[model samples]
Target: MTSIKIEHVVHEKCRIGESPVWEEKEETLLFVDITGQKVCRWNPKTNQVVSVSVDAPIGSVALRKSGGYVVALGTRFASLNWEDHSTSTIATVDEDKPNNRFNDGKVDPQGRFFAGTMSQEIRPAVVERNQGSLFTLFANHSVVKNFDQVDISNGLDWSLDHKTFFYIDSLSYAVDAFDYDVNTAKISNRRHLYKLEKDEGIPDGMCTDAEGKLWVACYSGGRVIRIDPETGKRIQTVKFPVDNTTSCCFGGKDYSEMYVTTATNGMDEAKLAQQPQAGGIFKITGLGVNGIPPYSFAG
Candidate 1:
């Protein structure tokens, strides 16, 4: 196993930075801070950062094929205007409940947006139930599929060949895979590809490289684990100082760089003191295969 070292690329206060993507068209990295209610864009080539606030809490974001980006807000999905910072809701998940919210999501090769949900309970503690559901929004706006009864919905990605789908149920400590029917937009044949010990921090965000391998961020394990989904073997590990490394994405001209987003929202003072790099963005260069270009919102 190769020792992984984390390099802090940007140090900023992000309440909970989660989803990250490299927009090849724009040559920038875009991410969301759910609790911060904001979206940010960073240009590694120019070394600049630009951000904007959203009306509601945002969970995930992705570039659209049309020219803009799609966002997963508290209970709805919307399109974002990066230049003007304007967002318009396109789909609603739980409008009647108002207690549940969207969590993490990504787009598939077919330009369909796949998003998950989380508990909206106000008990000041994480609850396993009361979580939202998974939804798929087709470009035509006439087709919407709902997969319900979820708890802490997190990472998502598809195999390089687009024949399989991988996902994370953070609290379950398991990474699962399903046989994907692209034309029918259905997932079945569920099986476990990786399982973690309770103490290894929950698995949150994930992405697949061009090599068809899985790269997952360890919520509190303070590192990213590169695993071969088929064999369920750990191929590599990237360590971080903070225990709350949230999500990661591959972006760059050649998609060689892996950009990571971290968090500090649920940490106590002692933990925060132990890791000042908790909310910053980190990058690992010169390694791993590139990732498939993110699918854009079909406008």
Candidate 2:
């Protein structure tokens, strides 16, 4: 196994830090504080952090081709202005399932935004029920449902060839692969890629590396494990000082650095003392791997 170096980069201690997106153009990291209702940017060069407040809880954010950002805010898809810190409605979804809200998501190679909703029960703790659905936002601002009965729609990425779609429904405690069509933004033939052991914790946000392997963040497991998608076995493990590793992404000049996010939502004072770096952003290096550039929302 290779020795990995993990450092706590941002120490703000967000309520629920998730969705770490690397902005290649600006050379900064953009992440969302779900319960804090804010979008933040961290510049590695100067160690400066800039945050924009949103009206509602934000699930995830992706770079927009036209300009600014496309966000999964609450139950609606909206456009965020990078400079003025303003947002405009793009589309609304899941009106019938009022108990649900958008969760983790990512952009496709063809510029479509893929996101999903999880039950509001995600707060405090998740209920033993599946009432969420996955959705895709086309460039025309139209939203389409892909599937439902998801307990917590999280972690999404595409294969190196763009033929396989990798996903995780946290409650399922497993990773799934699907045949994906980039041109039509449709996914089919879902199959289990791998299942996490009981001690590995629930799988949260994940992304693929340049090598086509998956790096998954474990919510209560306190570590990030690298898995070989082809053989469905563990390749490496990166342990964190905190147990609530929410999400992660590759950034830095050469895309060799992995930025991870953690949360402090359910931590009590005693547990918080055990992990003072909880709810902060972390950077990991020395893994000897590069990452794929994140796709932007063409819409």
Measured by TM-score, the strongest candidate is: 2
Cα TM-score per model: 0.94, 0.98
lDDT of 1 by residue, 30-109 (tens): 99988889999988777888999998889899888877789999888898998889999887877666677788999998
Enumerate residue pairs that collide in model 1.
64-297, 65-296, 65-297
Each model's total of backbone clashes: 3, 0
Screening candidate 2 with a backbone cut-off below 3 angstroms (N, C-alpha, C), the clashing residue pairs are none
lDDT of each: 0.83, 0.91
Backbone clashes (count) for model 2: 0
lDDT of predicted model 1: 0.83
Model 2: runs farther than 4 Å from truth? 122-125
Residue 272 lDDT (model 2): 95
Model 1, poorest ten-residue lDDT window? 121-130
lDDT of 2 at 214: 97
